[model samples]
Target: MKKALTFLGTMVLTLAIGVTIGQVSQADTPSAPGSADDPIVTKSYVDQKLAGVGSGGNTGGAPTGGSTTDASFKVVTLNPGQTLKGGEGAEFILRGGTATAIASTNGGVSDVTGADDLAQGANVELNHLLLTPRNDGRGLKVGSSTAYVLVRGSYTVQ
Candidate 1:
């Protein structure tokens, strides 16, 4: 009886130790880096990746870093009657000259700085942050003179 009791106690203790060791092992295991469970990312890497987002196609003007592929904001000079169309999420800031909003059929450009939506043919406020809601022909139309615009994201000149 005593031996049986000792054996039962040992078995219980062994089972408890096994469970503890299993938990410890699991806790010590490291998750794979940059995975959804880990998600470790450097600040520079994140900035570089974000800089390239939505910056596809023609930039209309020379971009920063002297490379067409650079996604940084560039100064675009538009002549009279020229149209600067923006892609989805594109941003523009008029620095000089007069321009008008080119709204899509569904909506218009969002003037974030002015807290308003610019309808088709509405005058673009200088230095106001204009955000295109979509890629469907939302942009700026140069007025009677040259226009200097700071632009980011995808765009084209027509």
Candidate 2:
């Protein structure tokens, strides 16, 4: 009878110790950064980072009213004869008006949406996502009217 009681007490003690260890390990485990349990930064910090983007030059276009989670596209208006030069990896989508591709000696703009390459003087397709492969003056030249374009990444108007 004594051995049975001792065995029961040992089992209870082991169970209690196992539970305590489990709880301790869970408490010590840190939540992943940028997760729901632990955010990487505050809302203000994210806002400040967003504000710094597209600060220089003519940022006259508003964000496209779409279901995008972030403001990645900047709408830009270009006058006739003006060129929208893109830096490396710059993305462009001609929203309105007419424009032509301005290719450098290296190559031309990549029309990802159309799955084609636009050489210099090629007409830019409206609503197509164009990507500049290099920073060597590859972009779009506005036609004889005001052109509206959605630009993402580094670019300049000249």
Cα lDDT tens digits, model 1, 40-86, are 98777899877776486445555456434445789999999999999
**TM-score for each candidate, following the candidate numbering:** 0.56, 0.56
Error of 2 at 138 (Å): 0.3
For model 1 the TM-score comes to: 0.56
Error of 1 at 64 (Å): 21
Tens-digit per-residue lDDT, 121-151, candidate 2: 9999899999998899999999998999999
lDDT of 2: 0.90
Each model's backbone clash number: 0, 0
Let me know the TM-score candidate 2 reaches against the reference structure. Answer: 0.56
lDDT (C-alpha, whole model) for all candidates: 0.91, 0.90
Error of 1 at 83 (Å): 0.3
